[model samples]
Every structure is written in C-alpha cells, then in structure tokens.
Target chain A: MDSIDKKLLNIMQKDFPLSSTPYKDLGEMLGISEEDVINRLGKYKKEGLIRKIGGIFNPRSLGYKSTLVALEVKEGKLEDTASFINRYQEVTHNYQRDHTFNLWFTLIAPSRERIKEIIDSVERLPGVRKCMNLPSVKMFKIGAYFSLDEEGEREEQKSDQ
Target chain B: MISDRDKKIIKHLQEDLPLDSRPFKNIAEKVGMEERELLKRIEEMKEEGMLRRLGAVVHHYQAGFAYNAMGCWRVPQEMIDEAGKKMSCYREVSHVYQRPSHPPHWPYNLFTMIHGHSREDCEGIAESMAEETGISEYTLIYSLREFKKTSMKYF
Candidate 1:
C-alpha cells in the first residue's frame, strides 16, 4: 500500500468522521477526492484488510454481561467441543491457545443466567474436563487501533535519501 | 434508558456502515428519520459511553500485527490499579483487565494483550511492560489458532 493508503487506514481506525458526508470529510483530511477515498476503502474492504466500519457498543451499558471462559477439552473432542461452543451467538471470540486449558472464548449475553446456562451445557459436553469463567473485575483499556505509518515513514525516508 | 427508536438506530449502526458520501443519510432514511437527527443521537450515545467508537475494525494480521500474546501478570492486590494504568500506556497493549484467577492452575490477575509484528516483538513488549511495572511474575500465552472471531450481534 502507498503512504496515502497507510495514512487513510491510520485515521479511519481511530477518528472516522461522524457526519452526513463522511467520505468527503475524510477526503478533505487526506487531501484526496471523495471518490478516491470511497474507492480506496472499498478496495481495502474487498482485500480483507478492513473488516468493517461501524459502531462498537458497550455490552454492559446495554444490559449485557460478558466473560472470558477457558476450557480443557480432551484431545479427541477438541473440534466437536469448539463447534458446540461456537453455535451460540453470545460467543464472539474463540481461540485455541498453547496451554492445557486450550479452548478460550469470550461471551456476551443478555444476562448472567444466560452465561451460566451456556457454560453448564459446555461442561456437560463430552471431553470437556474443566471450565473457568473469568470475568473482568476492572477494565483498564480496550482499543485495537494498529498504526500503519511506521513502514510508510521508513519508505519516505529511504526515498528522500 | 434507551428508547425504542434508539434501539432501531443501534441495530443499523452496529452493522457495516455503507461507504458513501452520506452514509448516515442512507441509514436515517431506512429508520424514518432525518440525517441530522441520527447524527445527534449517535453523538449523544458516544458521550454517554454507550458507544465506544465508530470506526474501521481492521483484520489485525492483515494490518501487519501478525502476532499477539496475552500477558497475564501475578500482580499484588494493592498494586493492580497502578500497574494496570502503567500497562495501558503502551500502544502495543490493546487491552488490560483485572480478572479473577483460579489458584494452583491460573494465578494471574492482570491481563494485558500485546500485539506485534512477530513473536519476538510481542515478547519484547511484554518484557518492557514487566520492567516498567516492577512485576516480574508473568506468562505470555500465544494463540495457536483462531477458531472464531466476530463482533457481537447486539440489537
């Protein structure tokens, strides 16, 4: 990607315009035409670089409860157990980490009871040995903005030399 | 308290917003409201902390942050808050949380997720974080595979 593309990604990750004509707003900030901004974003989306441009809501504020769950599934039943857990809409992120308690996932549900119900069902599933529900006592930070300008800056410096 | 109309707005806003010059206008039309009113409500939600952010959610690996490790620290109860704040200052640390730790098996209370270009880079960030916080007892758990990762479908 070009430097302009890197800059656009960086800006959109944190401060996407919240206006009637957001593309135009972004275009002005990036010194590109509105059409160009739209095209580039569209291209990035198609290329799987940009997942989505939307609102990230606070689940707790919306009367929801979320928790991180770690489970130790028997080696033979890992695939089945993961698929069973993934069937719930409440389960958003599920990963197999390098630990005895390998299957780790996050769930956001409408109520604590719902969270319990899902966990209970998973524990009953064959090959599931142990489960731990780790809910956040305090959240210090939660932002996932990756700066894409470092490489772009290096390229600029190289060209200047 | 959120009104029914606000729920309708939230439902649409949570989806992938259109890449148009007037994207909100399109959403407003669908929700039977003017563009200006929709913008106002969105701004209010943001101020109220109901909406965390409205921006691009990139694929991290695709964005060049191909490696990430969850650094779990065994912080003393008294120093958790101070250490959490210090850890949050790192740009590489996207999330820092204090969670319940099960004894004998899992004894780490503070969790900071570090993302980097490679495994070594992630470890380096964790090391610096350990040095800064003065908490040496920690473990960096790397994800071996991502089974599923998606945003919550809130209505």
Candidate 2:
C-alpha cells in the first residue's frame, strides 16, 4: 500500500466518519475529493485489503454472554469441524492453534443455555475429541489501538461507551 | 443545528453503526430526518465523545496475523505503565492492560495478547519481549481456538 493508502487505513480503522457523506468529509481532511476516496476504498475492497466496512458492535451491551471455548478435534477433521462451527452467526472467530486443545473459537449466546447448546452442537460434529470452556471471569482490557506509525504509543482502550 | 430528528438519528447511530456509504442517509430514513440533519448530529456526537469510532473490525485470523496467546506478567505496581507501554507498542501485541495480581489466588499482574502467523512467530515475539523488557517471569497461554470475538454493547 502507498503512504496515502496506509494513512487512510489508519484513520478508517479507528474512527470512520458516521456522517451521510463520510467519504466527502474524509476526502476534505485528506485533501482529496470524495469521489477519489470512494474509488480508492473500492480498490482496497477489490484487492481484499479490507474485509468489510461496518460498525463493529459491542456484544456485551446487546445482552449476549460470551466465552472463549477451546477443544481438541480429531486430527484429520479439524477443518471440517471448523467449517461446521463457523456456520453460526454468533461464532465471531474460530481458529486452529498448536497445542493439546487445538481448536479455539469465541461464542456469544443470548444466555447460558444457548452457550451450552452451541458447545453441544460443535461436540456433535464429526471428528470429535475433547472440549473445555475458559470463560472470562474478568476482562482486563478489550479494544486496542493499532497505530501504524513506528513511534506510536499503545493505548489500553475501553471496549465501548 | 440540533433537532428532535437529529436526536433520533443519534439514537440509531449509537446502535449497529452500519458499514456502508451514505449510512447517515440510511439512518435518516429510519429516524425520519433529513440526511443533512443526521450528519450534523453525528459530527456533534463524535465531538462530544458519545461516539468513539465507526469502522471495520476485521477478522484477524483471515488477515494471517492469526497466532495468538494470552501472556501474563508479574508486573510490579510501579513499573506496569512502563512495561505495558513497551509491550503495547508492538503491532503483534493487541490488548495490553494491568490487572491486580493476587498471590495464592491469581498470579498474573499484567495481561497482554500477541498475534502472529505461526506458533514460532508468536513465541519469537514473546522471546524478544522477554529479552527487551528483561522480564523472565512470564507465561505464554496460547489460544487453542477462537471460540468467540465480538465487542460488548454499551446501553
């Protein structure tokens, strides 16, 4: 990415404009026209540099209880089971790691029962093994700022308003 | 330049905060207000700190910065800020904050997350951190799976 692209990414990652014409407003700040901003962002999207542009919700405020559950899937069926678990909209992130409990994902549910239900759903998936739930008893920190600038300081950000 | 319609706009914007062009226009239609009025309220809310940001919270795994671990440090009260500052500066380190370390109960005084493309990469970052900070007493709790990753809501 060019300097302008990096600068734009930095700005967009933190505080995207919520205005009706955010591109126009952002262009004004960046000393470019609104059309240019849109075209550049469109290119970024096409290049897969930007996965999606949208409001990231604070799940806790929306009344969903979440937890980080870890499990070991049958060695060969990891990918299949991962795809199965990823089907749920509530399954925000899923990944494979190098450890005894290899597969990890985050699950948010409307209630404790729903959390159990989802776990059972995954447990029933082919290539089953062992599972464990490590729910966050306390949250030390959540949102973090990634300032691309080399000299930027790290900020321990509050998750939401 | 505030109006009742603007308040409605602000109310909706505080929720979901769509990722789309002309989001304010979308919100304006929902809140029964003109797009310009909605825009003004958003600008004001951002200025007032009621709205922190509106942007893409990407799927970290897909980005290839996937390897992650919960690192714990027995940070002294006096040096947490110094240590946290050092750890948080690394792009690989995402969340760095202080938590009370209660002995005979909980031992980790400071917690931070490190992300990378592979286990070796994550450990390499951790090793460098240990060397740079001279922090020998640390444990790397690698995440075996990512069960969930979402933000909390503020009512």
Alpha-carbon deviation at A107 in model 1, angstroms: 0.3
lDDT per residue as tens, model 1, B39-90: 9999999889889888898897776667889999999999999999999887
True contacts kept of each: 0.87, 0.38
The digit string of per-residue lDDT tens for model 2 on B62-106 reads 333456787778766677767777876676776776655546334
Off by over 4 Å in 1: A153-161
C-alpha lDDT of residue B120 in model 1:
95
Q: How far out, in Å, is residue A20 in model 1?
A: 0.8
For each of the candidates, give the backbone clash count: 0, 20
In model 1, pairs of residues that clash are: none
lDDT of 2 by residue, A1-161 (tens): 55566567667777676556788888888888887888887776667656566544445544557776667788889878888888787677787866655787888776889899999988877686777665654443456534334333222233332
**Candidate 2, residue B95: CA error in Å?**
2.7
* Candidate 1's iRMSD: 5.0
TM-scores for chain B, in order? 0.96, 0.78
**lDDT tens digits by residue: candidate 1, A1-161:** 98889989888877888889999999999899999999999999999999999999999999889999999989989889899999999999999999888999999999999999999999899889898889999998887676666564211010000
